[model samples]
Target: MSDTEGVEAEVAGAEAYAEAVDVLGPFNGPVLLAPVTHNPNNGVTDGVWDVTAGDRAAVLKVLTRSKGTTGHWAASDDPRHWNYWRREADVHVSGLAQLWRPYGIRAPRLLACVERPDGDVALWLERVRGGPGTRWTVRQHVEHLRRLGVAQGAVGETADRPWLSRRFLREYIAGMTPGQELLDDDEAWRQPLVREHFPAGLRHDMVRLHHDRDWFLQIMESLPRAFCHLDMWPANVRSDGPGSALFDWAFAGDGALGEDLGNYLPDSVFDLFVPAARLPRYAAAAYEAYLHGLRESGWKGDEHLVRLAVCASAVKYDWLTGMMLARAGEAQVDYGGDRPVSPELRYRERGSTLAFLAGWASEARDLAPRLGFPEAPSGR
Candidate 1:
């Protein structure tokens, strides 16, 4: 069956629920299933459901190769593709997700990974109960970053897995087509939120950041490599017992030593989980804590190189400002929903984040020459 048809049938079928029970097992009563709302913009995910049978509970996630309505959301059959549709299932079935247990972080336990008669793959996972990362205090956020450092440091320069994503930053960034014309359009920038939060100076820096994208990518490639959870961010993590439980292994793959921390710090503020005002304080503390974790794991790399990678990693979001500008005239929505939100609030929060990332771009330029990668002649 085609992915679209399969998804429609599975969501309406009793067979899917029965299959869940068969895979999850030992239920005292019939399972109750309820559809869980998730980000609908991503085309590959068929559906997520909350499954419960008496005292037992699990999360059921269905994955498919559906392209949805946009070229950017298309999934790939290639194992190395950044959005390979089967990567998450493979991570669970092969127990690769559990590899970081010794370092105090782990993916939720996989109760079952079922290949359905249709094209979709169903994953039944443990329902971890804890405060979401969005609600985490600064101290908790730093500790999680430390644990992430320990885990990635321990996996330093390991043999590549065919199913693990490769060149993720480059490939993912290439998929975005942010509106360049909107960047310089005075009318677009004059939107109330943009005018107030994204000033002329910050806008120029962001444009420079976009211009230096290729240069930043080159520097990141030259840095020390590690196995990374490329989507490490507030929404995908939670406090679970003594350690943390990370979700969404779809983008797990190879990355520079400090890339995950780079992504995490900005992401925390981008979604307004942590306020943009705390970014500087969090950046300093998190970097130090991450380095401490790396040292604990016997990684003796130069601190400056790691710092370079962390700062240069801002290239991953170079398209964000233009994208935001393109959408500035539209009715704004909350991060995870279609619910209408005030454009003023949305732009204010994300504009601050863009300003911070623009600073990282400047820092990356300074750090590059010191590390022997001289700045390329600017095309701008």
Candidate 2:
């Protein structure tokens, strides 16, 4: 009836076609179609296969171009745009998959890649051996964070200058700005909370915090560079029994040792906004665990620095929510959520989070003194 309906019908038919034939390769006859299911995790398009050929009953995956609304920046076949989602999928399925194998990192094994007649690319991958609903407990999350730290450090040990650098931050800051109109309505309710509590200045120095070129360089040079999973959140990762494995290598690149760990902490814990009830205690435990893991992994950098970075990371997202709200009037697909976070709520939560960081930073100031680690000497 419509474009959306047409796409959905095509997808449904494709699912049927995928199921009809044996999709697993090393086949007898011409391998045609395979049974495939749509992955629920990604708003983007992905194809999952349940293979019946092998005795072990393996799974396969094919990442495809998503047939989404034509506004947002996403992976597409368009040559005019910079991002080629299908091609990037191929690089990840091919390059990073092999690079991390020796380090005991768990991820799907790349099987093969194919190009369809329509000039689209598909990546065939070994199904990560797990099911849905593998909810992560705090301890499990800690363990996963440690593994991510390990991955970062391991990559850092050999490689140099991983991808999450000052350049990346500056680009992120510039690119993240959305239309000002999106922030006009509901933000009136929320913007005050942020402005009242947190530091909201647009000075060169503040934006510089988003991309401390020197800081990024120092962190990269100071730490061992290993295979860093740029997006190391829960959805992109899974646990198979006792071991944890990460998927989604689309953002994998070289970077600092603790960068991955720092990224993982805030992201995994605060999916949207941290509930006020769970802030202090949860943050304390998570911070302690991170510090302990870092020390064990031979990290010599100040844990406080990592903490600062993580705190700053939260603010960046808060800014992002504001930017997205500024675009709400448009008919674009709202990936943030459908419930509609008013600008007031966004500002309040962000302000509270910033207040929390300032409080933590204050404690950090006194912490060194209490521990008798060192003190700022009075020169004047």
Candidate 3:
């Protein structure tokens, strides 16, 4: 199949430049639309662009889909799979984006938008000029967490919006059973790197989690829910601005308290965007800052529940760990042609990622007893 078939290419228009001017109103100079790739580790759901209209520059994003990416995903696994294609447009047009903008939980400003009769979407968004999220220092990340807590917490569960993220974990995993997919092939984890890196207790913890995920998922739902930037990894965030500038609202939704930081704490290292050693300080900074922000936003829920929710939410990545270990040797990271990541380095990185995931799973198991949730019997 050609590259243009998926949702990302749906708006690869011959007249995207003209459409931008026509929809957004007159500009002094000719508008040119150039296709570009922004951060797409999640999925290529949008055809992004750098649009130059005379002297003024802006970005044009057109939502697109490719079955190659979605071939494994069943609509039943995530009912919103089709509907979320228009989530960004929904956020802007619904005025929820505007509601969160001033609290410093801003996204790129929306200039204009269009909804095609065929159910496609195009957005004219302000080009945010800032540094990527990976470069932020611990203090900076703490403040980012603080501002994120305040901004999103300010909205809390009070946004009264139905389209906000719901069942994000199930929706995101599509149809793959992370535990079944991994445990079915124990030999895959026997690969040298995983065998060497995965801790014994953690492995035992993960196996038990596979069979008893429902209770843990229930625990996650019990926590106070609010709007969460579901894809808050370093690649999807920028910290160069005075505060955080979030993007990619496709995965934005109702999530348990502290869930975004669950991903935030481990992903920079998981993707090897930053060194693994920094994770401790980064996580420390994030939790404290977020709690402070939660209070700043007047959240009065039990702090202990938030802490429990953080570890419980690790359920989201249970399958991801197994899947990563099962497929151990794919060259997943692209270096923008600057340099190739040596296979040994990649192997080590993946091993480290598995180890980190194991720790989170173990935390879930360990935290359960404390939270009065029964521990699942070990599969070992």
Deviation (Å) of 366 in candidate 3 = 3.8
Greater TM-score among 1 and 3 belongs to 1
Best by lDDT: 1
Q: Supply candidate 3's per-residue lDDT for 359.
A: 63
Model 2 TM-score, 2 decimals: 0.60
Better of 2 and 3 by lDDT: 3
lDDT of 2 by residue, 15-53 (tens): 323432434534332223244323233423454444443
The residue-level lDDT of candidate 2 at 320 comes to: 46
- Across residues 1-380, which tens digit of lDDT does each residue of candidate 1 receive? 00111122123268766876686666675666666545666766887777767687788899988646467668788999888888999888887788888899998899888887878899888877877777889999999989887887787865677999999999999988767667778887787767886755877887778777888899898888888889988878879887899888888888999999999999888777788888899989999999999988988889899999899999988888888888877887766573588787778778888888877888888878987997854746
Ranking by TM-score: 1, 3, 2
lDDT of 1: 0.81
Q: In TM-score terms, which candidate is top?
A: 1
In order of appearance, the predictions have TM-scores of 0.93, 0.60, 0.83
- lDDT order of candidates, top first: 1, 3, 2
Supply every candidate's count of residue pairs whose N, Cα or C atoms clash at under 3 angstroms.
0, 20, 10
User: Which lDDT values do the candidates have, in the order given?
Assistant: 0.81, 0.45, 0.64
Which segments of model 2 are wrong by more than 4 Å? 1-72, 76-95, 98-104, 129-134, 157-166, 179-226, 269-276, 298-315, 324-380
Question: Model 3, residue 85: what's the lDDT?
Answer: 56
